[model samples]
Target chain A: MENSVDTLLPTLDDGIKCSAITSTDGLVLAHTGSGATLDEDFLGAMGAALFAFGSKSIANLVGGKMKDIVVEGEQGFVKVTILNDKLLMVTVAEPLKLES
Target chain B: MQQATTSISAVQIAHNIEKRRLFIEKPQSQAHVTNMKDAPIYKTRPAVLQRAQNQDRTPLLKGEPVKEVKIILAGNVGSGKSTAIRAISEIPVIGSDAKAIERNALHNKESTTVSIEYGMAYLDNSNLHIYSTPGQRRFDFMADVLCKGAHGMVVMIDNGCRDPLNEMDYYLHQHGRFLQNYPGIIAITHFDDNNTDTSLLDYSTYLLKHGLACPVVSLDARNTLEIKQVLMNLLLQIGDFKTGKKRA
Candidate 1:
């Protein structure tokens, strides 16, 4: 099921421009498409940092689990979707219209 | 007759001497000076009490000035950007509808901001100046100018729309470059719609892939309480960034 989901990621519409499945520990389980040339490892580290921040924020505030997190920037948008207890689906996209 | 005249002269002389004595004598029976230092010790002797009052007065200085935080609201058109700003503002909001002015698309307005929309709010006793840019694409140039020097950004998205992902993309393309290092919030507005299909998890994954380490919250622009929570979350994120602590 996980492999099928991974294969479907790259073939997914442009709206899901770039996709990745990362563990709660911040390790990449699957990634499709290219990211900014800055460095994949460095980007992974940053993603972990963000995940930690989001998780902690939700936990500390509402005393609930963090289900999703989104960060917008001038170059692109990053979305972190919580799948189950220990996995997250991440996607990066340029300004593409999901709705007409 | 001579004797009577001498007597009158003597009486007049006695009266004049008594008057002179009264003028020269100082009252000695008044309260005794408790301490030598208590004696009127003016640095300079005054010719008169009125003269002492005219001496140079001490200079007065102004008090310390108050500091305020500036927050910028930037995003794409129909993103509820203005409503998001209004949510946190304590004062009345001043906004413009740029779509009304430039009916044509080809001729872009040189000044993207037709009018400025700003409001003031107090968060944690800290004064905040919140401003929103016109979300139209033609006004993007003006939005960039507005975004410059902002301490934070609140990027709003319409969640119920057919293409929220696309809206996210537009926001990134427009402000992602400038806001790469700055802290921000992704507000998914219009959640009250019946056809809302996206979940919080779906949105979060989208944001994680981008370089932002912020919170994605569902916001109902019309609800003040919900807005306050969103603002609190934004502040918490900012505090974490400054203190180098994990948000949790």
Candidate 2:
């Protein structure tokens, strides 16, 4: 299966400028295609915090948990997706529609 | 009566504990003290045992960049593996040394650790998960399982045990392949009662002779302060290894 960290993140489409697989504790397990100017460790840590915030906020406001989070910046977007309770995948890529 | 400047530091506490251990180890006229060979294999001090019993609260480690440092404590039977874990663990250790009932048993002797001993020690934001490997060769299967993510190890050698040097060699031969990646320390226990003129230098020499290297220090299993010192040494070694500093 492709559930392992190395296989999971690198297999993502080429649109991802940077893809980091990290534990829920915010430690980077595996990372592929680093951002030109972004710090990988700091990105993983902040992505973990952002994911926690999104998870809790959705749980409180709506009635369920957050599927993923998409933050759009001037240059591009960052997506934090929870792979499992113990693992998560963070990807930085150019703007793209969710359905597309 | 107002005490502000006359407070005890951790170093002072450690010094006091060492002094007490030295006093207890002194050759006295007391019969029971001299005849400890017939006593049980493990004798944890009253204070250490009480501390182990009282340790039940979860240490606060949330919202921090914590490094999960797993350390495996391995040695022969009755080498005080479990005692070391309990002495340093901030939480109540998961396993207790029970009387053994099986022969062709773990150690070909009485009293074995049928399972692994689990403990945790927290240093600032770095959290260490300590596992005491069962001493019997029969339980060698548990080595890989226990050492899954061990950052380092502290091997306890009982000077009182028969041919402790051979036992030490056995451990080195068994785990040296994997343990070379990280730093380790040797804790020579029971030297007080065993009194074979064994020193930390003896262990260091053996390791050097075998081309294996690590720090060797005498340890009093009953002293929590001494156990903490061993842990501090390992943590410092880890820090040195991580920072690419020169290692002794």
Most accurate candidate by TM-score = 2
Work out how many backbone clashes candidate 2 has.
Answer: 0
Off by over 4 Å in 2: A1-100, B1-64, B96-98, B102-111, B195-197, B245-248
Instruction: Give the per-residue lDDT of model 2 (tens digit) for B95-179.
Output: 5243443434334455556457789987534678999877756456567678876778888888877677777887877777654
TM-score, per-candidate, Cα-based: 0.46, 0.50
Model 1 chain B scores worst on lDDT over the 10 consecutive residues at B37-46
TM-score of chain B of each: 0.62, 0.68
Clashing pairs in 2: none
Residue runs of model 1 more than 4 Å from their true location after superposition: A1-100, B1-67, B98-113, B194-196, B243-248
Report the lDDT tens digits of candidate 2 across residue range A59-86. 7679776788999997788889988775
The DockQ figures for the candidates are 0.03, 0.02
Q: Superposing every Cα of model 2 onto the true structure, what RMSD results?
A: 16.2
The lDDT, on a scale of 0 to 1, for candidate 2 is 0.66
DockQ of 2: 0.02
